[model samples]
Structure formats: structure tokens, C-alpha cells
Target: MIALERPDDPEAFFEHAAALLAEGIAPEHVSWSGGESADLFAAATRAPRAKWRGEKLFAAALLHRAENRFSLVYRALWRAARAKGWLGNPADPDLCALRKLEGEVRRDSHKMRALVRFREIRDAEGERFIAWYEPSHFTLRANADFFAHRFANMRWSIVTPDLSAHYDGEVRFAPGGSRRDVPAEDARDEDWRTYYAAIFNPARLNLAAMQSHLPKKFWRNLPEARVIPTLARAAQNRAEAMIAAPPTAPRFSRASAPQTEAAATDLADLRAQLACCEKCPLHREATQVVCGAGPLNAQLMIVAEQPGDHEDLAGSPLIGPAGKIFDEALRRTGCDREKIYVTNAVKHFKFTLKGKRRIHAKPGAGEIDACSSWLHREIEIVRPKVIVAMGATALRGLTGQILAVRESRGKMFDLAEDRRLLTTTHPAYLLRLQDEQEKRLAWRAFLSDLAQAHAMAQA
Candidate 1:
């Protein structure tokens, strides 16, 4: 058996060694080293010896014999190198340390990808910047272009134990060095904290998700880390407050119309009337006024803001892509589609035609107000046990205010006569997000709200 170590041309040496191995030469019979040229000899002569560039003979030795008795091999190699005067003096410990550090760095590269947290920063010159970091490896220099292209207009830097790399807004991969502390002017701690606080939705608090994306190891360095615990506590408090708060006052004064004694009979008649009625300007633009549809005595009623273009054309509520997503959500939540009525707050399809496409236009407050009478009529007739508001516009028409959808979603509120109302995200919002992970998260929140509503209805 032969063991050969060539520091340079390791690949060619390995190929030759393999051919020799095929010719029945044993690996234990060979041993050689040639300073910086040792790798080349090893590459040409050794049978599958690990090859490393530059003066990484120590690391290569470790890597080559790692599966075997690597520690013993390393010690033997060290002793041999010292006896032969190949080893440097003790004054330059960096040479040995760097080699070992490089090996450790190679082993832990994957962890850096999982732990780095990037925060957007801005300089006094109004230049955008981002700061990120990893524990030890110089992976940032190798991968800086990925982030620079992602945020091309931003000046950013990644700090690591070995080095720091910076991007100057246009070009990437400018070298930088580690600093003991970030400059006061460059530190965007407060701004990052504020932005994180403002954007985080308390209603959709998921500790696991948060921790997965921004690991706890990085929390100490993040400005938003200070608020995480507080934010979580506040979210819990807000949830409890929602459960304790009294129902909002009814938006419109109840008219003195004759109270129908039988809900079942009134609901039947109202359903019939909705199929034929020409109430607002919507009926003029659309073919027919579409009404809510489900079991006559459904426990839950889902209310969207208005009919979409497809829904308007089809003369039915919730028959488009958003509706399909809503249906899937209902199935996942175990909500009985047969027992859940679906309708819109406004029965119109408002749009602006762009070329061949009809872009959806948000319904105005006045339009919503005009349509509220019909929504009120539906509520009176259906007399559902619970209502699910699926968007801001739907919530506005139902609750009669511009409420914070992010804050209010998933909580049950009292409608008139002890009926419950649950607010949640619109499917359209989920559709607009380009990121698959964020979309999945939003979808989960949407499902959670629906599940809560379903559970409440069952209760």
C-alpha cells in the first residue's frame, strides 16, 4: 500500500494513483511531500488522497484520513513535518490555526444560511443599506452578489468573524473588515425595531414560524429582538381584550318595519325576492342580481365585499379563483359547505377596462352604503348563527367602519340578536403575494380564522 502527498496538481495525481490502483498497487506503500508542491505530487500519485489548494496540507490530511484514524494520521504527519523541518516556527501560529479554522468553516457553512438575519439600513445620504451576519465563515464574500442583486439599489454589508463585505449600491463584492461596533449614524436599530413592530401582525402570531425564519441565535444582534417577547405578550393581551370587549354598536338605527314573526317563512320569501329584485345601479350594469346560496337554515354566512368580474358574469357569488380558494379553506376547516351560505356585501361588479382586461375597482363608501340595505335585508332573512367577513370592504359594510383587518381577523364579534361575526383575510390578498412562503403563511392564517369561525359555530 502506498500513500503519496502532492500539494499541487492533486487531481492529476489522484487520476494516476487510481490507474496504479487498477494495476494492483497498494496505497500503503507510498509516502511523499514537497512543501507547497506537495499537493501536486499527492494529486498525481496518491490513490484518492484529499486535495486542498495553497498551504492547507494539514486540513487535507485530516480530510483524507477522516473516515480512518484521522487524529492519529494528523499527529504522525505533524511529527514528521517537524522532524523534517517542513513546519514553520512557533511565532506564526496563524498558519496552523487558519488551516484548522478553514476545515471547521467548511463543516459549518450550512448553519450560516439558516441563521443570518438581514436588516435594512439607510445612511445620512438617503442611501439604502442592509446589515447581516454569520458566526465565523467568510461565506458572505462568496455569496454577496446574491443579496446585492436582490437589493441592487441598496448599500449593504455582511459581517463575519473573518471579514465583512460591502456593496456600494451599484457594484457588489467590495471587501470590508470586521468592526467592534457599528457606527451610531449607520446603526438603524430604532428604525428596524419600528418597522418590524409595525409590520408584524399580532393576530397571526406563530412563535415557531418566527423562530424558524429568524433563529434565536441571531436575536441578540437584531434590533427587533428587544420587542419580540413584549410583542408576544401584547398580542396575548390584545386577544384577551378582544374576547372581553363589548360588541360594537350597530351602525344604522333599526327601522320601524313590521317585525315578521316567523324567520323561516321570511327567509324563504327574501330568497325569492333576491333572485328578481333590481335594487341599485349594479343591476343596470350586470345581467342579473346574484344572491346568497346555501341551505335555507345555514348556520354560517360568508360575506365578500362584492362580486368579481366572473361572479358578475355568472350571476352568482363566490364562483371565481378567490371563491375556489375560499372553498378549499372551508373544506380544510371542516366547515359544511352545504350548511354555509356565501354572498357579497355589495351585489355589484365595479371595474375599469384596461385594453382587453377589466380591472377590479374598489367600491366607494357611498356604494357600500347603498348596498348595506340589501346586506341588512339578507341578515334579517337568513338569520345566520354566524357571519364571516372576508375582506375590509365586507367588514366595513357589515360593521360600518374602516377597521384594522390585520388586528381584527379571527376574533368573533356580536352582530344584532346575539349573532356572531368573524373577520379574516380576503383570498385576493393572498393571490397578490409573489413569494410562495409568504403566501403559504397568509393561507395558514386565513385557514386558522375560518377554523375558529367553524369551531365557534359548532359551539
Candidate 2:
């Protein structure tokens, strides 16, 4: 049997595996030599090497924090390299095991972040902070960067059984440390416990949920845990007291905008107020409210559904991928983009997170309705001769009714104040077309609608 050497280091492990594969070594021919899983100063990575880093599943599997991670990863990688349905089958046992390992590793990292409590200390140089924790896995080095970024100005050290990390402007990982190496408590710990008790709502207390999040194993080290038993014993009386207590004014209320509030004097004034508008929950998640751009006196107004990811960050409308297509089409039709007022029905971007990327999710009817007031005020100010609504969401935001853009495209309808409204497929729809002929036909139809709108504005 060919026993593995230097199995702790990722690069060395991959190199060994690569050489064995090149020698046509079979899986059963190899035997596992499971030693301590990290090499300290020499090389301490428990992840896949450079060549296999691109395979997300394999790389994540290598971070399992289990003693058998190396052997399990090699078996999984071997099956994958041999095309043994490891990559294709979602229910593959190896893949399923890797997913569970990755999830537990991630959970351990999150708990370490939440539970680490730093206390002030004095050294030969100056004041610094030190904290000690007994983490489930080797996460002290992995999470050192998070502490460095969060408390960049202050020096700190986090000690665990597996390793210890010190940050004096830069991060350095050292050998493991014991709880005696750090201070047990600081003067400010009492203040934190008081604040924790103040925020603990007895009415919302769920013991199972609380225990799940703050496990009994961690309670000994946590200062706030001292008050938990006392609080639980008195929870019933506290809840009753809360119910009998007289009602007080709210901490905040958006709907309570005073009736005596001053009205906006002009477009600029209205826009400045929109920037601070928290009338709906959408504003809380978005970067900022994006108001319309272009000449207020312009005869043509182009309205899209809402600001996309690009527009949200840039704090402007008609600047993303869809905007590029719309701008090119308008220029082709002999219409200057700057001459036309550009905006969205909803001023905030609505999206869901996909890794680091934000994927656009369609806004709901209520969200559109919440922002309808802003759209109506914009229309009142611009008083455009022709208004173009790009999609169903845009049409609904404008008129407060679900109108079919497919049925209404290219047909003009009279709006209030003798204004003309037209509907068309959103520029984003063109990018989703799979068939060449269908894309060409749709592009032609889109150009025709824009040309017709420009013609109506000119007339």
C-alpha cells in the first residue's frame, strides 16, 4: 500500500494525488496517513490547491474541518475525475456529504464571529484588546481577517485551542493558547449585560430557538448568559407586566408624516424629499432613491419599471444594460436621449442576492402602488406630450391597474391632460430571446415603437 505523506498541506496533497494519478495508481492501492491536519508555519491551508480551486464543490469540501477531510476529498475528487456521476447527480452521496460538511463549517465560522468577546488590555506599547474562545473547528486564522477589518484601528488577538491570531496592524497566526492567556472580564462587561437585558423581550422569548442559537456549551464564557436563568425564571411575570403597562409613543412611524408638513415648491424640492422617503420597506434595502433625469420641460418621458442594480448604485436611471439598448434605439430614430426625460415607475431597485451578484426580482403590486405617488407627482411636474411605459410593471405603476403590455404595445391611449401613453417590451426582454429570427423580429418591433413615440412628440 502507498501511504500518503504531507497530507495536511493542500498543495502537497494535490501534488501527491496528481503524481499517483499520472502513475495509473488505483484508489484501493492507496492507504490514508491521517496526522494533525495543519503544518503551522510551513503551510497551513486545508483547502484545494491552485488547479482544483475553480471547482467550487471540491474546494468547499476541503474546508470540512473534520479529521477525515483529506481522505474523503480524495475519494470524491477521484470519482469526479473518473466521471462517476459525482458532478451530474445531485443526489450523489459524496456531493451530499460535502454539502453537509461545508454547511457545518460555515455555521461554526458564523458562531465564532458572533460569540467572540474582546476585552481591553495594557501592554508595553499601549492599550489593546484580547479575547479567548474554544471554537469547534480551526477557524481562528480563517476569521482573523474579519476582526482585522472590523477593528482596524485597535490591536487584538483571538486565541483558540487549534490556533491563535494576533493583529498589530497586520495579521499573524501563532500556536494555540489557553483561556488563562486572556483576561476573564473587563469593567465594561457589566454595561453590555445591562444593555442585553434591556433588549430581551419576554413576549418574544422562545427557549428552543434561544438555546439553538446560543448553545449551553458557549454560555460559560458569555457574560450575558449569567442573566439568562434569572430572566427565564421571571419571564412570566415580566410578560404580564409588559401587557399591563400603559402604551407609549412609537420609536418610529413613516405613516405619521404630519398633515401640516410643508409641500415641495418645485421638481428639485420634490426630488430631495424623495431621497429621504421611507414610506415603504423597499427604501430600507436599496442604496438610495433614484429620481428621474433630463429636462423637466421635455415633451418625451421614458419610464421603466424600476432602477436595476447598476442604476441603484449610480443613483440614476437609464444607465444599465437595458439603458444602453434603449439609448441606441432612440439615437437611431433621430431622438436625442438628453432631450427626453428618463426615469422609473419605482425609484428603488428590488433584487435577490445570488452570491455577490444581485439578480433582479420583479416588484410586487403593493410596492408599485407605494411608489405611485412619486410617479404621479413626476408626471404632474413634467407634463410631457408623450409618455412611454416599457413593461407591465411600468404600466401598472402609472395607472394603478394591471394592463397587458403585449396587448397594448404600439397602440396609443389618451391620458390625463391630453397626454399620450404607449407601451412596449422592456429592453431587457430582447436580451432573453433564444432564437435568432425571433430576436431580429422583436428588435424591429421595439425600434418601430420608439420611432412612433418620437413622431408623436414632434407632432
Candidate 3:
């Protein structure tokens, strides 16, 4: 075995690994030398290195706290050089192990960044800040630039057992020192403790979550950590006190009645309210509230999912490409588009932008729920004999239960007060089917469902 002494740093390891690869040294034949023993083989020849420093995973794996990391990383690199695209195969055991090590190094770096507590210290030259931190991994050097960016104008020094970093206008590194070298107490510490206590909100206190973010291991250096236990003990009483506190008067008055009472009282009032509705985020970008357009007392009510891009701009439902398909289906089924009430489950068009064109995005459950009030108001006002619900969103709004279109189609279910609802495929679904045969079949099914709804309305 060509035993070699491994250095305790990434850049050094990079150079060492590159030399081994150049000399054509097999990974298994190499053993790490430490203490008294050393390599007696000819010096490793220089070769073109694998771009390990430029690769984030390789760089982070080198910083892992494990003792065997040096050999493991060397082995991985050796295999990667021989086997094409081995590093990219995440399913490989070696890559998985390497990823775990990288995660540990990153987590350690994050902890060091979060828990480092600085204290004000004045030397003969000027005011500066010093922090003493104990990180499990060799991450002080890796995280030094973070502090530089966060506190660019200030002079600061972070001293760990393995390394130390200092920054004024520029960053510099020095040899590590003991925690005893750092001053434990500072004048600003008391003020920090006061601030920590003042900002602690009892109402939002989550002990498990707090412990997860602020581990007990870091409490030794944090000034506010001393009071954490006391605050936790008193949290229940404090929260109760907050809950029992006298109700404050409204800072700004809204129309006193609830949305259900006010908005649902009349269809005209609901439409006016919906135009300015901020109930969900969908309204923020939508052109206008595309309310239902049809005769007031139409026998059949047709509810589509929501407005499409064209319908959004034109301020009408079922006027886009999907609308054209629906019109074709209506013509085939002998159903008059003007005689029936046509609206959407949601009033606004929800979409994501792809280049200049807007791609339709399915509305989430929260958005659907928020818009249900308007739908309910529409139903109350129109009071149609039969409702044809196109797509899952429409079915959900009318029935308040998720029903599959394929399973529920061609059948009518009672929807209270002698009214009925028929679930069917949306015209947009027909438009998405690329196969001409499948499109033909789906359109026939849709027309059949619409014809059934029309027949039910007449009955």
C-alpha cells in the first residue's frame, strides 16, 4: 500500500488527490499515514485535476467532520475519473454517502452563522467586535465571507478552536486560539438581553419549534438563552393573560356585517363586491371580475372552472377557445347557449406567465374555497332547475365534495330544493387531448352529458 499523510484541508486534499491520480495510484492500494508512519513511495506526480474545487458537492464533502472523509473523498474521485458520469448518478451508494457528508458540513456552517454571538470590545486602536464559537465541523473558514457580507462596515473577529477570521474593510485569517482568549462579558450584552426579552412574543411561543431552531448546545454563548427556561415556564400564564386582555376598538372600520351576510344578500351587490374582492391572491393580476352572463331566471345553470385568458380580457365566461368548443358541443346537443346561465366556479383567471403568453394554472383549494361565496350567491339568485358542473372545480363548488367526472357523468344527483347537478368533463379537457380519436370520443361524451342536463331542465 502506498501510505500517505493526508492534510486537514480541502484545497490541500485537492492537490494531493490530483497528484495520486497523475501517478496512476489505485485507491485500494493507498492507505493514509498518520503519527509515526509515512509514505516511502516516489513523490506523487502532478496531473490534470478533476474540477473538485469548482463542484459544490465535492468541496462541501471535504469539509465534513468525519475522520474517514479524506479517504472516502479520494476513493469517490478515483472512481469518478475511471467510470463515466458516476458522480451524477445519485442512486449510487458512494454518491449518497458523499451527499450526507455534504449536508452535515452545510448544516454545521449554517449553525455557526446563526449562533455566533458577538460582543463589543475596545482595543487601543478602536472599537471592534469579537465572538467565540465552537462548531462541530471545520466550517469557520467556509463561513467567514458570510460575516464579511453581513457586517461589511464593522470590524469583527470570530475565533473558533480550529480557525479564526477577522474583517475590517477586508477579510483576513489567523491561527486558532482558546475560548479563554475572548472576553466573556461586554457592556452591550445586557442591552441585548433586554431586547431579546422585549421582543419575545408569548402568543407565538412554540417550544419545540424554538428548540429546533435554537438548540440547547448554543445557549452557552447567547445572553438571552439564560431566560429561555424561565420564559417557557411562564409562557402559559402569559398567553392566557394576552387572550383575556380587554378587546381593543377597531383601528379602521370596515362595513360591520360579515361577508356572507353582506355579499350574499343580493346578486348585484355580490358582483359589485367581487369586483374589488381581495379574498384570494388571484384577483391581484386578473383583468376584471368575469361574472355569469345569461338570462336572470334561466332553467339550466352551467358552471365552468374559471375564466380563460380570452374570457378574462373580454370580461365574459366561455368565450375563449374552450368556449368555442363548448359552443360546438351545445350546437351538437341542441342546447341554446343564450337561454342558459353560464358562469364560472371562480370569477378571476388564475395563470402563470410563459414569455408573453399566459398559461392557465389550476386554482388551488384555498382559492376555490374563497370564491365559493360568490358561486353560492349566483346559485341563490339564478335558482336554476338543473346545474351542469364542468370539471372538478365546478363539481367541488356545487357539491362541496370531490367527485370524479368519469364516475359521476351521465347521472343526475339532487342538489337541494328540487334542483339537480350533473358532473361532466370541461371543454378544456377535450381541447388538451392530442389524439383525434380520443378527442372525438370525449366530445361525444361531453355533448351527451350536456344533452342530459338540458333534458333534466325541461322535465
Candidate 4:
């Protein structure tokens, strides 16, 4: 080992040592020992060495031995040098190398934290212990104290390139190669395979996001890596199958069993009963009771806010101006109206008379509450696979006021069982906008929402 004494300035020491290092002389082959005069001696000798002013020192000797050849000695001297702050400055290349080693140690510790899969293993003495790790660098001796404190009671060993650390109910670091004969008590590879398969969610698979988080390097060690390609292919196939599959048939919830059964039993009875319902006084001024119309087994259920003036007299759904817009939107979406059940949240018509004209009045909360029972019954009996909630009133009737209608309009929420509720603005709302530009924007939004709902239903 070479020794040289240099001045306090780190640059002088680095310059002297760098020149020597650049020469054929190895760091260990030179030595310098001096004080304030040490800088001049270092410049003269150009030796990498320990700077000393009597017992005090500013820098330690540098060695040019390979990592595998002198790892143990290098590590011991490195620790002593660090404790004495002999490196003068943090930016010194030798000091920088030491810091890089420190960083690598910390990175190894984190990797052990993330990837070590402890499996119970018994030694030749029949002592039980857990063992699972694969560290790529020489960090065992560098960070032995950490693992010693972490796994004190268990018998464990972490094998790395330079050394193997063992804790036999106590912590110990030994310099040697690892033995491959030790038997692992648990089959880690198989268990990981099972765990990997069970946790993969097919419903919410995002390939790009998944690949970003789990890069290919880590995948080589994971058992699930083998199945990733297959799983992705299966997901694509399933999505295509969904597109080809017919729309889901309506399903009645168990809660609506009695009402649904009644609705299914006699349509005439339900219509006759609703015609006399004075749940709200809207029926008195309205032309007639407009009931839901469509095939009983329809897969899609369209719930509008209320019956329009034309619909009230016609006693059918989608017969007014807004209804005309709805029909056009549906035609554009390629939806078959015959396959959908159309209904209203409010069964009774609420209107105010202005001369001979009757203007549509929004149903109050009370009317909505009173009429929800019939809608719930209709939902139960029809068991439509998907429910399209048009307008705030219809959405409020179905899902309550927990979520804002505008923010939640385009998303699908699982209501009960496999049933999904898709919310959108009513065509009437689009019609009411006086600004042509605003009307066009609103119509576009409405159409986009409907298109999304149609896709979701199909999915």
C-alpha cells in the first residue's frame, strides 16, 4: 500500500494522485508522508498515499487492485478512510467511486426488499430457516448489519458475487462462495406462478400501463412472465368475442321479484292501474297516461325524464320533438328500437296551461319519489340488460343524488348484478338551448354519450 501526505486542498491531492494514476505506477506502489510541505512532496513524488501531519491525516492511500482480487482489504481500508474523512473532498474521483459503491449497496438493499422470496429451508443440522434471494453485486458485507437487525431470529443467507452473509439465529458475514446444495423447504417458483395467475384482472387489463410498470428485465425472474403473452392474446380474443356476442338480456333483481312478476303477469292490469294513479295531480291536466312501450324481453331500457305534450296525448314514448331527435340519434348509432324498452321516470304528465298551450313542467322531487315505484317495477319485470338514464331526473330516480349527473353522464356504473346504468342528457335539454352553436355542441355531447353507452352495452 502506498502512502503520501498532501496539503488541505483536495485539488492538489487529486492532481498529484491523478498524474501518478495516469502513469504506469499503481496507487499502492507510491507513498507520501508530510504536512503543509506535503503538497510539494505529493507534486514531486506524484504518489497516491495517506497524508499525515504526525497522527493527524487528510487523505488515505489508494490501491489499484481489481474488485474480486482485494475486495475484503479494500472494503476495510475504505471504511477506516471514510471514518477519518481522509478523502479531503466529496468530489474526489476516488471518493466518488466510494459513494457510487454506497449507492449500489443501497440499491441492493431495496432490491432485496422488493424481490427476496423467503422459503423455509433446513440446514444439514436439521435447523429450519427461510432462504430466498439473488443479489447481483458485492453488497453482503457492505450491508450485513442491516440484514442482521432485520432477520435476527431466522437462519438465513444472502448470496452475492463477492461474499455470502448468514444469520444462524445470529448475524455473521463470511468471505466465501455460496454452496448450491442447500435444499429450499418451499417451492417458490410454483407458488409465484399460482399467485401471478390469480391476481391478474382480465376486466381492467391495460397492456401499455402494465408494461411500463413491470419492465422486461424484472419479468425474466417472475413466473408470471411466461403467461403474459398468452394472457394478452386471450384478452384480445375475449374483447372480439364481446363485440360478436348479442346484447345481454334484461335481468330482474331479487329485490323486485314480486313487482316484476306482477308486471310480467298482466300488462293490461298494470296499464289499467296506472291510468287511475293520482300519485301527483299532473294526470288531471295532462292529456293521457303515457306508459313504457317496447318488447317485454328487450335487452336495452331507455328511461326518459317525462312524457312530452305529444307523448302525453299519443300515450307512447319518443313521439315529441325531443323524441324525434332521439330516434335520429339511435338510427345513427345503429340501435334497433324494437330491441329496447322505453319508459319514463315520471309516469304522470306535469304541465301549466297558457291559453290553449300546455308547457311542460319539470317533475318535483315528490312526484319523482311517488313515480319511482312504477319505474322500479318496470325495471324488475322487463329486466333490461342495460338502463339508459336520460336527463337529470331519470338519473336521480335511478342512482340517487350521490354523484353529479353532468360529471357522471358518460360513464357506466354497475347497479345490481350484471346490470349497468348509463347516464346522458335528455334530447329536450338539447332542444331547449336557444344558441345554435350551443345546441350543436349539446347535441354532439349527447350523441357521443349515447355512442359510449351503446359500446358499453355491447362490451
Per-candidate TM-scores read 0.44, 0.54, 0.54, 0.43
RMSD of 1: 15.7
How high a TM-score does candidate 2 get?
0.54
Looking at model 4, residue 130 earns an lDDT score of 44
Q: Which sections of candidate 4 miss by over 4 Å?
A: 1-266
Candidate 1, 154-189: lDDT as tens digits: 666666644566767544443444434343233567
Model 2, stretches more than 4 Å misplaced? 1-12, 33-56, 243-459
Comparing 1 and 4 on TM-score, the stronger one? 1
lDDT leaderboard ranking: 3, 2, 1, 4
Error of 4 at 392 (Å): 1.0
lDDT against the true structure, each candidate: 0.65, 0.78, 0.80, 0.65
Give candidate 1 regions above 4 Å deviation: 1-268, 271-280
lDDT of 3 by residue, 1-459 (tens): 333333235765676577677778887766553222444663543333453343433778777667567678888988887898887798998888888998888888888887788988888879999999988777887788889999998999999877789998888988888788788888777877888889888889998898777677778888778777888788889999988986331121123212364755666776788888888999899999899989888999999999999999999899999999999888988899989999999889999999999999998888887887788778778889999899999877776666677767767776675678788999999889999999889888888899999998988
349-451, model 4: which lDDT tens digit per residue? 7888889888888898888877776777777778777889998888767754534567667767777876888888899888778999998888888888778
lDDT at residue 112 of model 3 (Cα atoms): 88
Shift of residue 410 alpha carbon in model 3, Å: 35
Question: Candidate 4 — which pairs collide?
Answer: 3-31, 3-32, 4-32, 4-49, 4-50, 5-32, 5-51, 250-383, 250-385, 251-383
Q: How far is candidate 3 from the true structure (C-alpha RMSD, Å)?
A: 11.5
